[model samples]
Target chain A: MPETIRDPADPRLDPYARMRERDLVGRSGRFVAEGEVTLRLLLGPRARFRAESVLLAPERWPGLAGALAACPAPPPVYLADKAVMSAVTGFPIHRGVLAVGLRGAEPEPGALVPPPPAPVLVLGLAGLTNHDNVGAAFRNAAAFGADAVLLDGPSCDPLYRKSIRVSAGAALIQPFARLGPGRDWLALAETLGLETLALSPGGAGGLDGPDLPTRALLILGTEGPGLEAGLLARARALRIAMAPGFDSLNVATAAGIALHALARAQGRLVPRGPNRGGG
Target chain B: MPETIRDPADPRLDPYARMRERDLVGRSGRFVAEGEVTLRLLLGPRARFRAESVLLAPERWPGLAGALAACPAPPPVYLADKAVMSAVTGFPIHRGVLAVGLRGAEPEPGALVPPPPAPVLVLGLAGLTNHDNVGAAFRNAAAFGADAVLLDGPSCDPLYRKSIRVSAGAALIQPFARLGPGRDWLALAETLGLETLALSPGGAGGLDGPDLPTRALLILGTEGPGLEAGLLARARALRIAMAPGFDSLNVATAAGIALHALARAQGRLVPRGPNRGGG
Candidate 1:
């Protein structure tokens, strides 16, 4: 059933109001999608689950009504006037639609990638605090055949509107989990028999010459401050070869190049299901 | 000269206050940065100019006074009480210091890339609204041998605090300019006699090929919509050779891989300087 909301102070909008209070729907365990395009993409067959609730600017999207009827289990769709919506969201609702969902249980680290022909790129959350990096990390993780992404230390939530938007919904599709701090992540990768290759430009060896194993965990830190020194000491620091007169690429971009090279070296391509869009 | 700010409501903080008001600040060309490390990087040798003003917390650092003394045109550093500093910034100023700088001038479209003995990897601004992508593009531009960068319409400013921080301060160092709609950036590339290659997975030609140019503009768009159909129609689409199984890498990561591969093909090595702190 669709409910029309006329008042900004309505009690039914507690979840939506809470979302406004926190600047996002979920504080730690929830993800939110804004805009009809992103919502459509998330609700598409490729996503893991249906949205918990859909908030819409009634006047902006006249066509959304038919679309909602088509969903297998149409979640609650909240319709509000643009001004009231803006008043609650604290900003003009540009997208006119927002979808909220739970942060599903993350797959166990080893479960993301098997010890086979495919190499898994494990992005280590080093000193990166930017939400965009975290989102881009997920995007790169999906692109480079990383089995899953792990995060540590004040990293942005993948489900955050900004991160999801930045990742182009790649964060929603990519397999990711938080492994907490360095010690915990290192031990898990070791137990999984993954060759942990830490990416650092200061490393003694370049990425190409490394004697990496088939099941490699390519650990990367945020830019500027690469891997934590202790983390670097624990993992093998390797450099990605660059063009003459270039310094270093962004961390996510670096990961992409490394992943592409490694994937080519392994001679395998990742396959997206039927829902894989144009690419 | 440095000033001590004991009150949060001091009128001097008016300019800095715009940082939080996204719409106003986005319209006005201004951004903010905090922390000594970020300030130091932003103030490196290649940095064009000093920030407008700085808000600092007292007694946090005894040694920083010497560094401030060395600036050619030192900024207005305000030593504020912790509570007062937090009140003005609308967030806890953890860096013990906050610096506000006027966004620099945008570069002319053609001026972005330098005359190349070095190859230029130009990141196309096609419907990329995410600030992170803008930031990542700068990071990639610096990592690759791109002499300059160009920004198109509806794209976020490279100097936005999010972008500046995301690019690891590369946005300041890299030569970047902006272009308005209908200017036809692809046409400009053609006029510049530079090979224009748009990164698209749909392209028939693989990225690692014999015909790769020594000097090229590697353009990329936002994730979903990909490249604008009009622009893509004009520019030749080039796909990065990926493992058969993967769908596609994140736009930034793809650029990274392309930059690495193309740089190698062009016989470029990563430029090294005193500032190559890739930890």
Candidate 2:
């Protein structure tokens, strides 16, 4: 139900501020979402919420609350002035809305692979601390119908507020998992029967190599370092076809272009099937 | 040219910290490039610059300052311990290197557009405060061989630190201009005889519209509340051919895909021309 909150010190709005503190959020297992648009976008079918809360301006309550009222949501909606909202969130959120939803449950990696095997763009991010790049990768992964995204060692938290917003809520829909670094992750994927294709700008072969495999994993590393030498040596390396003067594409853009190439190679992104467009 | 700096409060490093304050950067006409990778990338032919100062680890001086020493670089490099370097820039300066370069003068809008006949994807962004998206747009613009990028209204500063890094220093090379919002900007574009294409999920025809003019301007808005209605109405609206269940692609990824489509339409990004492998 909707509730008006006059005092900024209200206990119900505690989760909003708690998310900023690493220790508190880690213990509580909560994340924050700012603005009505992302909140609305995340409220689609198949959305599984663990905890959902909204801090809204008075003018925004009617329509926003009504939308929730029509749904099966029993989450709390805290109404407050813009200043109070800013005080609680630690920033001026002009989006007029915020929601703290539970992180969704992910399926086993085995289930994500398409039948008869379509090429998968596996973004192998190691030490990629920037939340925006993480989010942009998820958005790109979803746009090009990547089979799944596997996070390698020391990457930034994908559920971080900035990542979610930067990803435009794509993280909520795209399936991803932390597959820690080293030989074990590669071993597990090999066991699953997926060929690994690591992206290297200096690699001998272009990304559009001959005899496109139906089931392959495209691995990517962090921004500057490119790819880990150990991992690059283990997996088959590929390079993007580009003009000479250009050095390299941004990791996320390269990921998008790679996804497009692999999807087209496997005929996965072709406009067909259900009237509903490709996700 | 590179010197060791033991004191964290060294007065010479003020310009580095000054770049941190977003407001002061615009007023001072200065910006900082962190890491040896980006700083070197920014030192290319198209990137004109006069180094105001540089901060680097003492050990990196010999290897990193080679090209700078040959030129008439007035700004001496300031060396500091890892801890002191971390304190200067809000985030950890991973490569133990940083450089403060003057903001090079931007060319006039008319000068950026190639003299007719060629395909140009001029990204007109409005209300996109996220620096990463701006950077990603620059990255994509460069990847697609866009003639130039034009900014209007209140958009994020391209010179912002995060944007420069996210763009992989492409912001240093791509030509851009800040034109205020009005009919004049559009009129000037029309005078150049460039067909303007506004990207919207709900825009009229799909992304692969018939025979798009070779020279065109692709206007992209922030994630939600897409291109302003007035702007969309005024330009040719186009939507990407997306699958069902998918709402929209991240603005940058969408730009990459659309640019790929547009380049394909214009026959620019084909596997030919100067891209012949191996010298």
Task: For residues B82-172, write the lDDT of model 2, one tens digit per residue.
Answer: 7788786655666887877787676777788877776566766666778878988888887777778887757788778788787777777
> Pick by DockQ: which candidate is best?
1
Question: Each prediction's Cα RMSD?
Answer: 5.4, 5.1
TM-score of chain B of 2: 0.86
Reference-based lDDT, each prediction? 0.68, 0.69
Could you give candidate 1's per-residue lDDT for residues B149-251 as a string of tens digits?
7777878777777787767677767677777667777677876667888777776567656888876877778776787666666767777665443355666
The Cα RMSD of model 1 versus the native structure comes to 5.4
C-alpha lDDT of residue B179 in model 1: 72
TM-score of chain A, predicted model 1, versus the true chain A, to 2 decimals:
0.82
User: lDDT score, residue A252, model 2?
Assistant: 74
How does model 2 score by TM-score?
0.78
